[model samples]
Target: MDFNRKEMDLLAIKIRKNILRTIASKGTGHVGGSLSIADTLAVLYGCVMNVDPADPGKKDRDLLVISKGHSGPAMYAALAARGYFDEGILDTLNKNNTILPSHTDRLKTPGVDMTTGSLGQGASLAAGAAFADQLNGSSNYTYLILGDGELEEGQVWEAALFTAHRRLTNLITFVDANGKQLDGPTDQVCSLGSIEKKFEAFGFHVISVENGNDTRQIYDAVMEARAEKELPSVIVLHTVKGAGVRKYAEMENCHSTTVNREELEAFYQELDAQADDGGKGTGKEA
Candidate 1:
């Protein structure tokens, strides 16, 4: 499938804007991690995934499993932009009895294929889903997104081994290696030595993108991962935790914090400038 770089870039910026708006509605949220994966989510929902907003559970459509469930705002933005639901619902995020929760839930959201929040369980669930699809002779792909810190879980390794053993080439996983977690920098918390090598050792066809905030790079990586037919694939995305917003991107504790609505207009102005410049500022590029 071919992608229009300009369109992808615009979509990514819009997703980032929506993320901030959604989190701001709740006063505070997982903004850092959510912003980190905006570009990849744009690539997937824009042209890669075979999902229908009108028919979300179509049998042949590609499925996405977000292991790092805290990043639901990004996914929700993509979904709303893709017409899965009205964008107005984003204001209900994390509110009582709201469909758009802080974490992804398949039952609560139209585009969410798997409900996840316990860190490593989404990996196992994605693996099992892929294995099931393999058994049923389905041509659909199961895409999984994991936070870099999530790799610290022993269960992630177990899921990796299972996917490798099963040879589930239809499954493609992405690691949002934004360098920070809920606590602090991933290295300071628990160094993950060479994420690429670790996945490679787990028998995955690993691909790394230096600038994960770039939509073009992320799209290319997905295409490359799709070409691998022998083993499961993982794309390690080296992204900025709060990309597209200079203020948050540079913060040491942007993981979960109150988004000052008074500052959103200024932030949006910056995003507009970046978009006009083809997403150059804020380290985001098409």
Candidate 2:
């Protein structure tokens, strides 16, 4: 399918808006990470991935496993925008009996392929899925998204080793290197010292996007990853925590915070400004 850069960029803005709306319904959420990955999700769900919203369980359809399950709000927004479910259900986020939980759950969410929350576990699960697909001679790809802090998990490296050893080219992984995690800056907590080099050392093709919050860059990187025929690929996204919202991006702790309707409106204002400027609406001022 041909990718429309403009359409994906607009979709990213819409996804960010809905993400804030979803989290605001719950009063608090992992807004930082959720906001950061909006562009990538937009590029993937907008046109890249081969998915059927009407048939969520379609056989051999491309699957996305968000290892940083806390960012489920963004995924939910993307899914809703892609027509997996009614956008009205986004207001039910984290509520009692709501399908949109705080984390991604395969059984609960229509488009979520794997239930992920326990940090590094998603790496193994996605790798296993790719391995199975490879064995079955399936061309469908399995995409994985992991938080930068989650990379500290030993199991992530273990899964990386396995993926590289097995030459799981069908597996494409992304690290949301937003530089901030739960407590504070990821580097301050535990420096990952060059995520690209680490992935290269692990025998995986690594692509680093300087402005990962740009849908165009994310889409280009994904295209590059898809063209690699030998080794597994990982794209390290250099993003700002709480991207696309100046107020939240400036906050000392946007990882998880309270967001009222007023604050949500302020975020929308910033996005609106970006939209008016004919940009991707990530609120990264030039």
Candidate number of the best TM-score: 1
Q: Give the whole-model CA lDDT for all candidates, comma-separated.
A: 0.90, 0.90
Model 2, range 174-240, lDDT digits (tens) per residue?
9999888898998899999999999999999999999888777888899999999989999999988
Regions of candidate 2 where Cα sits further than 4 Å from its true position: 276-286
What TM value does model 2 have?
0.96
Q: Show pairs that collide, candidate 1.
A: none
- Model 2 local distance difference test score: 0.90
Kindly list the per-residue Cα lDDT of model 1 for residues 149-254, writing each as its tens digit: 9999999999999999999999999999988888888899999999999999999999999999988889999999999998889999999988888888878878
Model 1 TM-score relative to the real fold: 0.97
